[model samples]
Target chain A: MNEPQFALRIRQHLNQGARVDARVAAQLRAAREQALARHRSEPEAGLALASNALGRLGGVRGLSLRVLLPLVILGVAFATAVAWQQTQRVAEVEELDAQLLSSDLPIDAYLDQGFAAWLKRRASQ
Target chain B: MAEAARLAIALAAALLLLAAPPAAAAPEKDRRWSELNAEQQEILVPLEGEWDRLEPAQRVKWIGVAKRYPKMTPVGQKRVQTRMKKWVKLTPEQRKQARENYRRISKVPPEKRGDLQRDWAEYQSLPPQERQRTAPKKKPVTAQ
Candidate 1:
């Protein structure tokens, strides 16, 4: 058939309302059922997959350390400061102790009120 | 390879965190004679010439003494300055002897120190001949 005639015949048949033969009709029904079954199973499988992902993320193993990092750094800084201050204090005390041990006169002679009184009395005498 | 790089970065960060404290905790470096602040320099002016030769411990002690200088009464300050000058002039042997005497005297009980002081004073008050005759016998220095 000529191209115009063939195109006219296909359009007329589409407009007239076509029907499938029994075998083709059965095949179409089976394909539709298979697609619907696959569609139904897909949603359930997707939900199960999402649930598994959420479960893994909800446990302690999934916790992030970033939240605690600042606290850890602050604690370290404070400890360092305290240790440095303690050493400075110890150096001061040791210096004082060494001086007290090395002086020519007794420490009590320098600090004792009674000794000072005697010195005054002897001077007067 | 990317995961390994991330792990290495994390480990480096952790090591930095661990090392930071000790690095900061180390005592400040020994200061040079010229590095003393205005106040320290003023207080330690007497030892300026000998500052370079002083041992680290001696310098530390002197710095501590300088820090306490301003708090002292004028009389106390004068006495300390005088004593420091005397201490500086002493030979090492004389200083050692003084330290021995100091340590030995420190051990005497507080109550007994008064009696000892009285005896020493009375001894000093006597005539030179009597003082020499009454002088205590020499004894070995006590170990601290």
Candidate 2:
């Protein structure tokens, strides 16, 4: 209906937490009226015409890349970090394998210095 | 004259022997386990057992730490000794309890753990009297 009545309805809805603000409701009602008038004036070329035009223009894709580029960069950065962490773990495993294969010392010898010293003494003798 | 020719051949053989990649000296095996101080030995014995079961790669990983043992600070050494003492003193039941506690603590989200640590710091900073006051009180039961 009129703006004042629409605003009152919106205020009531907002008070109940339905979130319809007076200004927004009024704008919505105006848009609906305009849409209805357009349909009445051009019955044959209705909402379908608007829908076809939106489809041809690829609707949401028309938004500028400025908004989407940051999201794309963030996703790439997250994936790279995950990949780098995986590679780091793999490298650590490889290094451990290399060290193990190259060393000749018995595991106990590394832990026990007295045993190592005694062995050295025996070898020299 | 034939003896001089044989001597030259012997010299050539000696040079060839010297050139043959100094027979890969057998890997220097360290036998340091017996040298540890009693306390150190006590700590190391279990570690040795665990090390024995480890794959070569795992053993190699720990060898680097072993090599740096002499460079460890006195405090570091003492801390290690204390941990070893504690490990030795624990009953199997107590060790199980400690392990369960560790697992429970580990499962907590990092943010929650950070918050808890911060709270602990705050609690520790409070005066002894204030801490006593904040401590939980036993509730009295009323008969219905």
| Residue A66 lDDT, candidate 2, scale 0-100 | 37
Q: Fnat of each prediction?
A: 0.03, 0.00
Candidate topping DockQ: 1
lDDT by residue (tens digit), candidate 2, A1-125: 99999999999887887557899889989999999998776843654455456556766545433334344455655554465555455445433322322233222222322332223322345
TM-score to native of every candidate shown? 0.38, 0.21
Q: How would you encode candidate 1's per-residue C-alpha lDDT over A1-125 as one tens digit per residue?
A: 99999999999998765576889879989999999999978855865565556557665344334323344555666665577667667465534534553344444343332333333333445
Per-residue C-alpha lDDT of model 2 across residues B1-144, encoded as one tens digit per residue: 643654565555455445432432222233354544465444355465444444443333334333434455665444443353344344556544443333333344554334433434554575777555533347633468
DockQ of 1: 0.03
- Candidate 1 vs. true structure, TM-score: 0.38
Off by over 4 Å in 2: A1-125, B1-78, B115-144
For each candidate in turn, the interface RMSD (Å) is: 11.0, 23.7
Candidate 1, B3-111: lDDT as tens digits: 3654565566567667655654333345678999998887667778888787675677677677667777676565566566556556656555555454445565555
Provide DockQ values for all models, in the order shown.
0.03, 0.01
